[model samples]
Target: FSLYRSYFGKTSLEYHLQTLENNLTNLVKRNSELENQMAKLIQICQQVEVNTAMHEAKLVEECDELVEIIRQRKQVIAVKIKESKVMKLRKLAQQIANCRQCLERSSALITQAEQSLKENDHARFLQTARNVAERVAMATASSQVLIPDVNLNEAFDNFALDFSREKKILEGLDYLTAPNPPSIREELCTASHDTITVHWTSEDEFSVTSYELQYTIYTGQTNFISLYNSADSWMIVPNIKQNHYTVHGLQSGTRYIFFVKAINQAGSRNSEPARLKTNSQPFKLDPKTAHKKLRLSNDCLTMEKDESSLKKSHTPERFSGTGSYGAAGNVFIDSGCHYWEVLLGASTWYAIGVAYKSAPKNEWSGKNSSSWVFSRCNNNFMVRHDGKEMLVEASLQLRRLGVLLDYDNNSLSFYDAMSSQHIHTFEISFLLPVVPTFMIWNKSVMILSGLPVPDFVEGTSLDHQEQQQQQMGLCRQESPYLTGMKNCH
Candidate 1:
């Protein structure tokens, strides 16, 4: 058993060893297969690693692009917000400007309303009415279709006819409120040297109650003097009843401006002032009252002594002397002022003054007699009147003399016509109208000048001398060289 068991053990041992070898061989084979598989797997893992690295790099690039896009979107949103704010500011400014304009317009209307509230009720009503009228007028004028070629008055008349209702309404209101004032149409006519006829008619004849008349000397003064305020009774003309009343006792050679008014309870309307000038009468030499030796021209203004023309025929009014000849003017001054010029050319002896009719026709003129003489003889100038003698001293070499006689003042004044220098003045009261007398020696020619004398003589000038001389010096009617020559036509 031992031997069999031993041999069995040895066989078993051998079998087991064989099995171990077979198992070892198969294990080796499996280990090799596993190694090969592990190798293949390692190569595959390397390739996968490379692919994974590339994928990671791509993923990083995509992440950077996405971040940039997000940043850009945020910036756009911020810019939109800024623009919206600026638009809001602009809208707010525009709203403020609109509000300011509205405030200004409202302020002006408020001011006008306040001013209107302060006016009187009547004044406010008138202003409102006037404003409405102006507005209506403006609207009507603007509505007109202008035709430049048509007649303006005719077109306006047609236009006015359409709106005549408004005019009638206004007129009715005015008539109810007040009476209409009358208009005076006046005409003035000068009848004589001291008389004027005034004729006037009222536009509304029955509307007048009475008339008021006023006159002025046209003394270059704008103010007028009432006729009732004049000096004498002759000038005190009562307001006459008729329109054909005449104004009498006015001064001659005086310009007068007259005004008349038609009066009523409604109102007084004055007529336009009418101007009238009185007549100026000049005297001429009388041949019937001249000396026989004295000769007179055809015009009766010039008188010269002529020995050959001295015929023996004499009248009662003629002077009986041949040596000293004299002449008198035909006209006599009874009222009003008279001015005349006499040219005494280079005379050794000359006399010029006013004398009464009772004076001696053949005797020389005297101071105590009824004669006022401004005489020059042998370079001696004197004024002889009323037995009074005054030596006249002046620088003027006079060739012509101016004589002014104020009948109301009973005064006579002499002036150097060529130089306008005042010579003398005399106060006299006579019973009758005085005639202008002239006497000359050495055959001196006494010529009456046609030059108009200045109307600047002060009435009854017993005061001023230098002022009168200055006034006369500037009042030369003609040149001194024209003493012997006549006025050229």
Candidate 2:
């Protein structure tokens, strides 16, 4: 039993020593953690001290600036008051001198009159009295003329130091903060073919000293933040004083993103971006490229087949052939998207399309490799490219034809303007600049350019797969009358 007690005591002592060692380790770990926390707290205190000093210095500097401004204004006002006092004193001294001179003249005149009264002899007295009376009359008139006019306005009533508004402003002075961002007035903005007038409004306009306008072409970029961060693509117009600005020489038929910044000495804030788009470029039919047998009227926008050939100088660009009666537009399109409409007024036979600048002018458009056209010969409608004609479904009574040329996207689409129906689209890989081409065998056709793309047209457009399907369907069967127009043209 004694031996058992000794062994148990020894085990208890060992357990106590292990527990003590664990407690010591825990205490050391806790103490180390407290020391680390204290060091961090010390660092925070030092940072706080430095920040407090920096803010204090900034406060003193701002106060000194305010004081200096007040001192300068006070000095200016004091100088002005001194100048006013000097002017008043000088005028008052001049008036006093004039009064003294007038008084002395009156006294002299009175003395002369008294001497005249002293004369006793009748004739001498009469002569002396007459002379004295004349002298007195002259002296009175002279004194009236020499008297200085006293103006009540010279009391400095008009010169006022009304600094009540300024005092209120000074009292309201505080730390200035960045102005609130401007809001783009999208509805108020206007755009032309080559210019965009951006209008904006600011909530804190009084605090803003100037405005900055930043803009860039919007090329289907959904992430505006990334687009704006690209500094090289942006165009900035700084120090704009007015709420509106007009930017000229912009690309026609293009979309742009704009931001206005309200800036001041305190700081600046940018407005939310606004998207604006310019209209399609305005173009007229080129009379210079018209066939000699064709008649152009209505500012060269309407073309008609003329039986009598008109007198015109023939150039290499003019359409000159037996059956190739065609005309090209005035402008060449190489970039951007454009939309124009052709008014087919009582025209049964017509071809509307685009052609390369180097396209043969003396040949029927769409019969060569350089042009693509949507043509209607009598009741048959077809799209022809590179001498290959494909039949397409179109309304027989279609009056207006819409053409959309997306040069960058390499697309040429035709639409039924009245019904907003998609007629056809050509996916061409254009390697050269192209111009609008028109050919008519009967009646007249008019063009309307510089029009915005219609909403229905945008929504009704087919996707890539659908477009490919439609293209394949249109090309599935070649037109049997392809050789028929060979003799007609």
lDDT of each: 0.64, 0.86
Q: Which runs of model 1 end up more than 4 angstroms from their true locations?
A: 1-259, 262-280, 310-312, 386-388, 443-455, 459-462, 465-489
- Candidate 2 contains a number of clashing pairs equal to 0
TM-scores for all predictions: 0.47, 0.69
lDDT of 1 by residue, 89-187 (tens): 666666556656555645655565566666679877678656655644554464231211222332222321143785575455422111233233343
In the order shown, what is each candidate's alpha-carbon RMSD? 57.3, 12.2
Candidate number with greatest lDDT: 2
- Residues 1-489 of candidate 2 have per-residue lDDT tens digits of 889999999999999999999999999999999999999999999999997798789889988998999899999999999998899989988877887877787777788778878888889989888888887776657545446566566677687778899889878977778999999999999988899999999999888999999999888889988998999999999999999999999998888999999999878999999989888888999988999989999698999999797677889999987666778899998887789999998998889999999888887788788999999988888887777788788999999999988787778889999998888888878999899999988888999999987876665445543764567466645566565656446
Q: Report model 1's TM-score to 2 decimal places.
A: 0.47
Error in Å for residue 186 of model 1: 16
Indicate the residue-level lDDT of 443 in model 2: 89
Q: Which structure among the candidates has the greatest TM-score? A: 2
Measured with C-alpha atoms, the lDDT of residue 75 in candidate 2 is 99
